[model samples]
Target: MGTGANCVQSPYHVTGSTWQTTSTHFRKQHTPHSLMFVCFSVGWVQGSTDFGVGFNLALDYGLASVYLENGTTVDIAKVEGGQVYKAAMRLNDNNIGMINGRTTYSRSEQINFKQSFLDNYIYSPNRLGGDGNGNNARSRALSLMLKALKTATESYLDSKISNAEVVVPFPASESYLHDLRQAVASVSLHMPMSAQPPTGIIAARAHGMYGKCFDDLDLQGHDKSMKNDPEQLILTIDYSRAALTALLVDEECGVFENRRVIHDTRLGLNGLHQLGSITATDLLETALRNITQLPLDDGNGAGLKYISNLVIIGESAGDPRLHDTLRRVLSEQLEPVTTVKSGFSPPIDPVFAASRGVAWDCWDRMNFQVNE
Candidate 1:
């Protein structure tokens, strides 16, 4: 049910017809060829403190990525012998068996229960654990995935994991957030509990603003004039499954101060038959107009603030055709007044943006104790 060249049912030890769980240490007992995974714990030494981790696990994307950071270095952990993890997991009755990236359970009926946790989440929210989800199997799967992430992280890093700041791709249900925290604890991993929960993708985008990736070279159509401005409005486009959302944010000096969702619609996704990516481009144009016309810091519409940077993110945000179209369209719309500098550089922007951004956020907060 997996795609890797070595994909197979996960391996579990058998003790005279009885099943016994295995640990990461079990990998060293066999040669690399005989083993289904890489022995990540081989040469590394454990560190003094737990690590700061950022988890970008949007089940809709069908995969998860963990960005674990120490003080100076960041490790994109290798789970199931890969950096990106499959969202698939094997189930045993109502119990979660070996997860895709962590360990594998070699059982005949593993495929019978092989399922995507996120897919289950959509159809039956409760069965995945808490909030009427009885067995907590879904939450257990999540916790095991977290364990896979942490073990994978520790495999490369020298430190143990403290916890992670789970970045919700969008505003999820209260039960969803509740299960997220609960899942963290189930693995002995920690996520600081608080009255306020992690924000939507907006917060991820905002935190991304402070990452080193925001260097001038990565900024498209960056204007020298706007460089000195104390505050600038930013228009961020988050596209997924062809659906797109335009967000407006106030960047005060280097800080993201105020934000608003200007447009949320599936107009962008309706472009399957449209000519030359017209529908998606039009929706973006509408979003741009909405952001530029909004009231500035004073809440007065008398003074309009245009967007300085136009950033696009998501799994499918890497379409070269879309990139060319957006650049050309945005340039046409705002060239004379202000260049909407784009942050839509392919593969990297869409894939690593959220994980890396939130990792930096986790790192900073761990070091400085900032309010989340």
Candidate 2:
């Protein structure tokens, strides 16, 4: 299962749903597996929307659709819905859309819903080692999120998952990542838990970026361009409401290389949403400068000089208002550079793109393990 600021995704086995492997190399059929990728989303700001990918997945495959929760499913196009930093969940038998937003709650419920936006349980210096009441709610909320996914997954699989691996966004700190891992373990759903990778040292963007570079035609074109010209670079932006991650991609002797994951705290998604247009524009300008000016060695004496493609992703990137603002600001900044061939483009299904990419990454890893 993968949860993002905008959506929760699982590889669900939709009964009678047909799927096409992007790569023809995989067309030689295997023992059919029941799971297909699905996404559930909610509005980020207002916390008032809920939808799923089941109906569209079924419709796309010309299969009969089945409702798993509350009979709500969405058009595949709606995966690009502009919402960020909010997770969708079922609470008190009713669906909760804005898990991240602040709302009034009973003293008991406050703790659980208070830190709902982030998977990391906020801890103070005093509560670090002691299991405090304040920590329980956040922990429980995380568990509940996992429990919900497990229930849906098991229902679709018709069996319990013995070992479940969750791919979480690479967090800011190691301790926070450890806390996130522990939260999943505490759920005790009888599935051994694992996270994508350790925190801070890597970027969650890597999984999606690698997945895209693996097959996505547009991204593949960038790779081919890089192979022909070593100086060519691809800029990938992971634009989530919580944070913005930037990566530089290149091809070294026909092999795709993710050069580095750039970190800039000043470019956080919450900061962008909270700031006025002028301030946000300024922040974006600074971010663009930071992105284009990354000090990466491309083996040539000249460092990165040309960006062939720019892939914008994440739920926030899909927001027309935000997208326009950032694009306008970025265009203003890039006009002087004059090297990047393609300008900013809104991500294709920004919400599910990352989750689907992550799913592909997991599938590859699992296949590797099986072959090994």
Candidate 3:
């Protein structure tokens, strides 16, 4: 079971007949589960005035059990209404005030909750060797889970089976899978290994939870552009021109300091300005860096040499200003890095030439790394 923020609690009605008596009687008969409890606190501060509110919530799932009798076993999983219960405790004086001709609002909020369930029923044989409390708890939990799984399996099989194999599936991160394998091995050595080897199921899921985010961006589209025109330089710029424009208007007029107006236009202008200058430069530099450091390799370093000089490159090929900067830099600094082939045959796509020229010009303007 895991503990987190969202927890359910019982509802209360203030204007009800004999509500207090009913609440008391209900509490007496129902034993609350400590695991499924939540506490929340809220507070607000304005100037010197402070106000606060707090509450506790609890949830309970009905119990289930397995019993062995007459050489037979029975197991059941039953849950209650799962109705949430809540109680509020308040200590505050509500008040509002302004400070420094501006409004200041502050509030504090907190919630803590834990789950009440023994969800896992399998234990790994491997254990970390350490006296640390964390490690001990983990080892103990694993043992319990394994024991539970064994019992469940024996009950399910309905045979006089003293040992049965169980397989645990884990995602395919190499490091994690290795660790799990070791843990299982350790467990097997401690306990009798099943006559037949237990299966280890590796999930086919990809690494990195955010892999979908990259896929959603559709970066593959850029790959085609890269192949069509290797060395296609790209640059992106955001001037925050809109924000600057708004600020300019504000400065000219008396409404320059208006909070609402400033807040609305400030973000747009700031973003634009950043995109035009810093963002543009960043894109150019990234492309250049990638070009110089191509042929990336995996842990084995097997394919590095094969693709080392197959020059297919691109950068943030977007803005003309940024492209020009890159061009100047290349002409000055990169000229000495490699011998330029004279009378070279151009690629079918002429755009690559324009891309190279732009990058070279940009590089030259800044004297290529001298001012970098």
Candidate 4:
């Protein structure tokens, strides 16, 4: 998506099947490549205002390149391209004809068949504001998301991918999955049973910590470490216009077993700024406090332990002051001296972390899974 709207599509690397950090164990158990990776069939698709449709034209304007733009130019992505472009891109099953005076636009121009309704369309219905269309609006939004996915999959493979395994936010509910399935059906895309998108924080951790591919050079003095400790765990907090989510991951096991919370609130970066530093601090502190009580399994029938690290990300984390405040507050509150980390995905906003995580997941599913 875009940094302005606070969505990340993290960059990923595929070394056989394992995602992010690789290990000797995974390497040793090599299996024949799965057909899933045979033709780049598995992919991740995300929408965003920050990632505008990229169009590059030569000086002669003879050779033109056009495709869904990623988080390259923030200013361009933030700009609302146009109502026509947006509406047309928000693909629905119905036609959106315009009657201007006595003349009407052609069917091709009026047809709502391409999905590009920005990133907001995928949100739950309640997250949708009082646009007043209600169910119709929600249905249309989901349709657009599916359309966008189809278009992205087709582009990524450079061919039509009839079957795909899609990634969604972690802890996606049955209803959300059902909606996605319907969208896939609407677009004539087949979703495999095994294909699933990991939650937002895990994906971020893979790119930021494990893969070490996440770029955060802009976050001066940011605390990002590549150390992996089995007994140690990390907490990741994600902020966006859609919601606030957190999770804990075991470094050694590479498993995200606990979900801190998925607070459904429209309070985005703008909302945080509006709430001022103190209120935001209190709100964040409340969320982090919940982590202190989370049970930690040491795998030896032993009791829980303190989280070793805490990483904060999303568009809101861009504010150095906010990042610092979060770090300080969490440090003061966590049981053990939790090292706080703040960083964004470099070359792209930290927003792409989720998308990249899913892409890597698809690659892993296709190439790494041993049918033992």
Candidate 5:
């Protein structure tokens, strides 16, 4: 690691992290940059847009993000339907439309949700550690959070959340997954756990950002190409509050197949409020180096050398400094000829990038099942 940054400067002094800025000044993303003003019922917001990613993570209640029916992501703070930095986001299940707004649920204004499904979903953005509660009995805090979400959701919908899907960290131990499942079941809730990487893949699929599945395309994105070009190698970097995860994924048709994983538990955006104390460059450089060095599964397809597409998510991924550092690392560590692909324009806010993707998958399955 680069021994830590001596003095970190504000992002205002730096240029835009990439040609495609994920949002406005990346620095502001450190806090709950969004507090949507829409109806949200039975949603959870922990450190970052919660896949509710991890356990007992501290949360900034100032801004909360949720994904609506049309794949729109918004944060609502200090208002009805959604509250920020003060309490969990809550919306009247029946009165989900036009909460505290002049526009009542006119026929055209209301979203056409599946009769059995809720219309809105919560997406935790960034940061996941210390939930204002101390670190002891961490899992207990997570269980309570889920339990509360369950109660609030059921109370409003007058219907059970038949399916509560959660995105856990990639490569979670079997025991941890079991404990999580037990906790959800203990609260009379059913949660299906998915590894973190799939959440990103689903998000990418929803946006069609990586191109249609199972076809020959250029080295990057979904845009059509004439030549039988090499498959796109998308490197997904999730810089979250508790950890930094790099997933090397190959396009398997339209879906993503995880080829490798690199994790850095020591270096995260929220190193326990020690963002300024640590040197992000050193840790980032180390992580990126490891990613490039990992071997493919016995040369199944193109190696890391062909990683032409980059999809960076997580609250920290929005940092201008981190973005700058990432560019620097890619240029210095990778082959001189390698050109890291920048420019990500997803359909929804990065905050709900993963959550929206998860919902899209669920929505498709539900539609299929309901139709059947």
Candidate 6:
């Protein structure tokens, strides 16, 4: 049931009871006591080479280290007396194999090492371009990240006791979650392991959109006339749609609640603004509260329970007032959510900015729904 390099192995078809047994086996065997954190940052290019300002946020945070399964012998040291062996380590540790017609080592030893390293470093298909063309640049990058995660988890487990946990950081958006899930599924399909599928890997936000900002009347206008005014609601949704799209394309695929946009519109002008501010403050507070509750072991434990690293990103960041408000909100809400100042630069280049903005406008015009 092993597929070659480019394809992932499909999950085995089993009876209902067998499926349950498999699931339980995976949970029991793969769950780690220590957490492994992996962070991913998404962004678009800016003007010419300037690229304006691309949103760069930590994608993973829970795991301590990532291990490459395959080990490359970089250097050969000579040990004198008890250990007097000296040799040179090569920089480019290419795959071990016969170069010319000479037999470098015995067939048995060569075969054994080749099998071992192959098992350690999972092979990934590399294609040109990041435009999401099948297994293109984006997929390659994802594969590399997954391989690193797999290697890291195995290495950590080898040196430590069982029951250690692993954490993976990602955007909280549905799209991001989908991408990550796909990446993990891809890895599980390719990698061969004795233990069941790895579990206990928590996803934390490295950068997130402030739902309050999109909900506020100051930013997103609302009407006070009708009870459930469709016109006013439409305007608010449009504004939110624009803002969210701007942030996503410009701010490294930041996560925010689409429901908040609908809620803000339903509340009307004054109500929306007040609620937005309150929600923003509450989000910050909640983050801080969770930070206080982190387990006292290694830093990994904190990532497992709560987001330890924070990167704020958006188009509103250009405005001094909005930027200050966001900083204050984070300070008040989540004490542990570290605000890394990215200055006044825009996350995406100007060229893409307008396109992304237009995309938002189109989506809003069509009345896109979160469920959709």
- Per TM-score, the best of the predicted structures is 5
Off by over 4 Å in 4: 1-139, 152-158, 163-165, 195-197, 208-229, 274-277, 293-304, 332-349, 368-372
Compared with the true structure, the alpha-carbon lDDT of candidate 5 equals 0.37
Model 1 misses residue 87 by how many Å? 11
lDDT of 6 by residue, 157-241 (tens): 4532111112211112222323434554555532221111111111111112211222235344555332321100000111110
Ranking by lDDT: 1, 5, 4, 2, 6, 3
After aligning candidate 3 to the native by TM-score, how far in Å is the CA of 285 from where it should be? 24
Error of 5 at 257 (Å): 2.2
List per-prediction Cα lDDT, in the order shown. 0.39, 0.35, 0.21, 0.37, 0.37, 0.22
Q: For residues 1-372, could you state the per-residue lDDT of candidate 4 as single tens digits?
A: 211111122222111222324421111122121111111122333332211121110000101011222322221111122333333222222211221111111111222334656435433335654233334333344455545554654464365444333433223333334444454456655433432213344344544443223236634476566333344556665554333545554444342333233332323454456677788767656555654454555556774556666655454446565466556655544554422223443433444444444433333333332211
Candidate 3 Cα deviation (angstroms), residue 333: 34
* Candidate 3: residue 172 lDDT (0-100): 15
- lDDT winner among the candidates? 1
Error of 2 at 173 (Å): 2.6
Candidate 5 vs candidate 6: which has greater TM-score? 5
TM-score for each model:
0.52, 0.49, 0.18, 0.52, 0.54, 0.22
Q: Which scores higher on lDDT, 2 or 5?
A: 5
TM-score of 6: 0.22
Query: Which of 1 and 2 is the better model by TM-score?
Result: 1
Candidate 2: stretches off by over 4 Å: 1-141, 170-172, 188-232, 249-270, 294-296, 321-348
Query: After TM-score superposition, what is the CA distance of residue 66 in candidate 6 from its true location, in Å?
Result: 12
The model with the greater TM-score, 2 or 5, is 5
lDDT of 6: 0.22
Q: Which lDDT tens digits does candidate 1 get at residues 14-82?
A: 111111111101111111111111101111222322344555554333223344334343536423311
